[model samples]
Target: MDLQQLPGYLTMALPLLAYAAFLVVMHVGQRRLGALAALKVPLHLAALGLLLRVGAANLPTPWPARLLPYSEALIIFAGVVLIIRAVDAIGVGYLLARLQKRHVPHILRQGAILLADFIAALIVLRQYLNLDVTSLVATSAVVSFVVGLASQDLLGSVLAGLVIGVERPIAHGNWVNVNGMEGRVVDVTWRRTRIETRDGDFILLPNNVVMKDTVTNYTLPSPLHRVRVEVGAHYRHPPNQVKAAMIAAARQCPEVLAEPAPSVFLESFGDSSINYRLNAWTMDYGRQEAIRDEVNCLIWYQFQREGIEIPFPIRTLVAPPPEPSAHEQRQDQIERIVPLLLDSEVFQGVSAPDLLAVADRMNLLTFGAGEMLFNEGDHGDSLYLLAQGRAQVIKRTPEGGQALLATLEEGQCLGEMALLLGLPRTASVRLERDSRVVEIKADLFRELIRAHPSFLDHLSRLVDQRQRANQELAQALAQQKTADAAGGIGQILRKIKSALGL
Candidate 1:
C-alpha cells in the first residue's frame, strides 16, 4: 500500500477492529445479563461515530467536503445516545425504591437520563467540533421562548407531570377516585396519566387536571377496605329483626371478615320503608363490587325468608289486619317439629306418644344466621334437632381461627353426646342461615331414655360413632383433638349412666 493512503487504511481498519472488540464484549455481557441487550441501538451508534470521526481526521478530508461537517454531528449524536443508555442501565428508579422505601416515578428517572444526554451532547459539540457554546446557548434561549408561546398548554402539562412525579402522592396500580371518576392508575406519562376503569376502559387525564383534581386513593396505607351495603324494609317489620337479618346476611358471605364482625345501622325512616346500612370488612378490594353484590343478594333472600317486607313508594289505601287462630299456630308448630324427629335415625324407636311427650318438654328456638348454638368448652345441657335451614360445625383452631368441620341441614341434630353424657360440647355449631330447632334439655332426655330400656344401647352406640367421627375431622383440620375423660367411650358411658341413674 502507498504511504499516502496508509493513514486512511489504518483509520478504517482501526474502527473495524474497535467494532469487533465491542461485539465480543457485548456477547459476554448479554449472556450474563440479558438486560444489556437493550443497549443495542446506542452501541451501534457509538461504533458508527468512531468510524466517521477517525476517517474524517486521518483521511486528510477537507472542511468543504459534505461528509466532513456531518462527522461532527454523528459524534455528538453518538455521545448523547451513550449518555442516555448509561443512565437507563444504572436503574435509577430501582435504586430510589430501595433507598427511600417507596416507588420512584418513571418520569423523574427518564428526565434524569434526558438531562444527562443534553449535557453530554453540548460538551461533545463544543470540545470536538470547536462550536461556540456561549453564542449557541444564547440562540437556543430565543428559540425556546417562541416554542413555549406556541405550546402553552403543552408546557403546563409537562410541568404538572414533573410536579406530580416529585410529589409522589399516587403510585401505579392503585385504585383512585378523581372528581367521581373511579379507576386504577395504569401509567403516568409526560403529558398525561392513564387510568383503567372498572369496566375495562382506558381514560387519559391530562397531567395538569390530575394535579388540580381531588384524588381519593383507596389502596393507600392498607389494602383492607370496608364495603357498605344499603337496604330498606317496610315499617311493618321490627327494626331489630331487620338489623339482625342484614347482619346475618353479611356473615354468610365468605369474603367478609369474622374478626371485625358485621354491623348494621338503622339509617332513617323513609317514605314507605326503614332504611338500613350494613358494613363488612374485607381484604379483597379488587372484587369489591362482586362481594357487595353477594351481600345484597343474601340480604334479599334473608328478608324474604323472615317475612320482612321491603316496601315500595306507594301509600296503602287500606291495610287489612288478619289474626292467626290458636289452633292454626299449634298445628303449624307440630308439623314443623314432628317431621324433623321422625326423619332422624336415633328417633326411630321413639313412638308417636313418646315423641309428642318429648316435644312438649322441648323449647322451639330460633337462631339468626352466624349465631353460635354452643361453644366447644361450654357445658352442654341440651340437644338441638334442626327443623329448618342449615348450621355449620366449627372448631376453634390453635391460631385463634375457626375451622369448619361439617354442615348440618334440616333433620340433623347436634349436642347429643354432651346432652346424654353430661360432657362438654365437642364443637361449636353456628347457624348458617335463619333456622328453627327443637332443643331437648338433658333432664327431659334422661327421663325419656329411662322409659325406653332399649334406647340406651342405641344412644350409646350413636355417641361412640359420633366421637370417632369428630376426632377424625379434628385431625384432618389440624385442630387439637378433644380428649375423652380418662377411659374413652367406657368412661363416657359410665358418666351417661350416672347422669341418668341407670
Candidate 2:
C-alpha cells in the first residue's frame, strides 16, 4: 500500500510514457497501411502498456514488497481485459447489426455499447482495487438524489434521449420539417440531433426538445417523395380540362414517375381561379423542387396550347395606364431584344448591328412558375433565353423515370445544346417562378447564324466551356461514387484524404 516508499516514481512513469509513444506509432501505421489492416493494433497497445507497467514494478526498488507482485499482476491483467473489452465492443456492433437487421438503429446501439463498456470498466476497477461498489453506490445514490433535484431538466433530457433512441420516430437522412426546421437529417447524436436545413443552416435540437416537438420525415424506409404544384388557370377554363391539362403536364415531364403517375386534385375554387393540385412522385428530396419546376412549366404550356389562360395574381385594382408613345414602344422593344441577343451564346462574336437585327426577329414571351418551357424528347427548333425566371433541367433515369439534375436560374439559357448538337432534347426544362423569357424560333436562330459568321466561333467556345465544366462535375461524381463504394464514413474520409493528396 506504501507505493511512495518506492525508490522513484520516475522509474514507473518514464517506461509508461515509452509504451504510450509506441501505441501512437502503432495507430498511425495501421491507419496509413489500411484502416482494416490493423484490427489488433489497440489490443497490442493495451498489452504493451501492461507489460511495461509490470516490468516497472519488478525494478530493483523498495516498492510494496508484499503487494507489488499481486498489484502489478492484477493491474496488467485488468489492462489486458479493458483492451479486450474494447475489441468486444467492436464485435458487439457487428452482432447487433445482424440481429437488428440494421433496423435496431444506430443511436440505440451506440448507447448500449457505451453502457456495456462502462460496466466492463467498472468491473475491472472494482475487482482489482478491492473497491466496494455497493458502498460507493449508496453514497452516489444520496448525492445523485440531491443533484437530481437541482438538475431535473438534465435528467429529463437524458430520459427523453433514451425514449427517442428506443422509439426512433426520426431517423437519419430523413427530409423532416421539425419545429419549422425543414431539411435533411445529417446525424442523430446522443444528446442532440442535427438537421441541415434546405437553406444550408445546421440546427442542433436537443433530444428532449425533439421528443416533445412536431416532426415530419419525408423519406423514412425509402427516398420516394411527392411534390405539390399548385396551379390556377382561368376560371372560364373547365375545371376538368384544367385538371386533365395539369396531370398531362406532370406526366409529360420526364422527371415525374408514372406508376405513382401524376394525379390532380381539385384543391379549391377561388374568386378568380379554380386551384388544381398536381401531385407527382420523386425518388429524391434534393431533386423534388427542381422536378416541380419542370412539371409546372409543362402544365403552363399545355394550358396555353389548349387556350386556357393562366391567371395573373392581381388584386383587380387601378385603372389601366395610358398607352405608351411610339418612342417608348420602340425603346421597350429594344429592351426586350437586348436580353434576347445577350442570351444567345451563339451570338457573342456577332457584330452589334447583326445582334440587334437578330434580336428584332426573336419574340419575347413571359413565363410564370409552373410553366413548362419544354419537355424531354420534345422536338424543338428554337432556343430559349431565360430573361428572368428560374428553371430546372430534368433528367430521366434509363429505367424510364424523371429526375431533376440541375436548376437553371435567371440569365441561364438552354435548348442551345439541342440546337447546336442537332439531337433530340437532352432534358426537359421548366420555370420555377413567375417570370419572362425570349424565344428565337428555329428558322430565325439559323438565319442569324448564317448572317453572322462570327456567331459560330463564339458558340463553339461556349460549348467547350460548358463541356469542361460538365467534365469537372463528372470527375467529382466519380470520386464520390468510389468513396461510397469503399465503405462507411471513416473509409470515405480516408479515400478522400488519399485521393486529394491530404
Candidate 3:
C-alpha cells in the first residue's frame, strides 16, 4: 500500500471520486434549478464529468494489475442501467398505479426501476467472482416464507391493495361514499386508501375492507344527486294543494333544474297532519344539505301565502295554562287595543289624547279551530289584533279565484285597511288553528273619527287617485270618440305640435 507501489491506483480512484463529486453537485443543482431546469443543464454537465472519468481510468497506466478492473466496473454499470431501462419499458410501475387507483409519483416509478439495477449488480458480482448464490437464495427464500406465514394479515392487505390497484374501483381525486362515509380519495398507499371528508377529517380504509365493502364513486361519469325535504301539512287542507305549492316553489328556485322537474309525494298521515315529501334534483351534491335547507326556508314562507299549515308535533294539553294574575290580564287587554291605532287617520291629523281615547275602546276575543268569523265582501265590523296562534286572510279575485294573502302570527293586525275606511271587507277573516285575537270594531273607530272631523281632509286626499271606475270609463270613451272623429294620426300630430309650441 506504499504510494510508489500503487500510484496508478491513486490516479484512477481520484478521477472516479471527482466524478462522484460532480454527481453530488448535479443533485444540488437539481434542487436549486427546480425539476424542469435540472433536466436541461445540470444533467449534461454531470454526464460530461462521468464520461471524462471513465475515459481517464481506461487508458494505459504505470500502475499495478490489481487496479485495472475499471473495465468490469463500466460493463457492470451499463448492464445494470440497461436491465433497469428494459424493466421500465414493461411498465410494471404503471400497472401498479392502475391497480391501486392512484397516480404513481415519478420518484416511486424510478425506485421500481432501481430494483432492476440491484439485481443486475448482484449478477455482475457473481460473474466476476465465481461465488455460488444457491445457498444464499435458498436461505432467503426460507426466511421470507416464514415471515409471510407469521404476518398473514399484513400480506393479505398488501395483496388486496395490489388487487385494488389492478381493478381500480376507486381513484385519487374521486369523490366516493364507502359504508356511509362521504369523502374524497386522498391517497392509496401500500396497505390503505385514505379518504378526506367534507368536514376536513381523514379516514383510512384498509385495502381489504375497501375491496370487500360497498363503495360509491361520485366522480365517475357524473356526480349529480337529489335532496329531499319533508314537510307536514294539516289534514284540513287537501294534499294536492300543498304538493302543487311546494313543486311551484322549488321550480322557481334558480338552483333546481327544469328537466328533471321537482316532485312531491304524499308520504303518510299522522294523527293531525299529512306528511309530504319534496324531492329536488341537484348536480352539486357537495352542497346537497345546504340546498335542501334553502329550499325548505323558501317553502315555509310560501306555505303561509298558500294557506297550507306546516304541522309540527303538537303538545296540546287538556288542561289550560294557569290563569294569569289580574295585573297580567289588564296588561294583556291593553295589548289588544294596540292594533286599533291603525284605524286612526285622526292620529295622522290630531295628536296624542285623541288616539289614546280611540285605543281605549278596543276589546280582545279568542276563537277555536273550526271558526269562520267573517266573509269576503261583507261589511268590515272590526280590526282584529292577533294575540296567539295563527290566522289566514282569504282574498277572492275578480276572476273568482281564491288565494291566501297572509298568515298572521302573534302581534300581527288584520282588517286595518277595511277599518281605516268605512268599506266592505276585502278578505274573509278566519281563525287559523285556534287563535286569540283582539277586536276593535268599526263603530268605535267611527266614534273616534267623529270626534275629529278634520281627519276627513287627510283621508280624502289619500284616496284621491282611487275614483269611481264608471267615471274613468265615461271620460275615456268621450276622449276616444273625439280622437277618432278628428282622425287618430292628425290628433297625435296636433298634440305633439302643441306640446312643442309649433
Native-referenced Cα lDDT, model 3: 0.66
Ordered by lDDT, highest first, the candidates read 1, 2, 3
Which ranges in model 3 have alpha carbons more than 4 Å from their true place?
1-136, 218-222, 252-257, 271-273, 304-307, 318-502
Candidate 1 per-residue lDDT, tens place, 288-343, comes to: 99999999999999998999988777777876678678767766777667777888
* Per-candidate TM-score against the hidden true structure: 0.52, 0.50, 0.44
Residue range 299-398, candidate 2, lDDT tens digits: 8789879999877766587688899996677668777678556655556766667666666566678775677888878875678877776888787788
Of candidates 3 and 2, the better by TM-score:
2
Off by more than 4 A, model 2: 1-60, 63-92, 99-102, 221-225, 266-274, 283-286, 301-308, 315-502
Candidate 2: 10-residue stretch with minimal lDDT: 493-502
List the global CA lDDT of all models: 0.79, 0.69, 0.66
Cand. 2 TM to true fold: 0.50
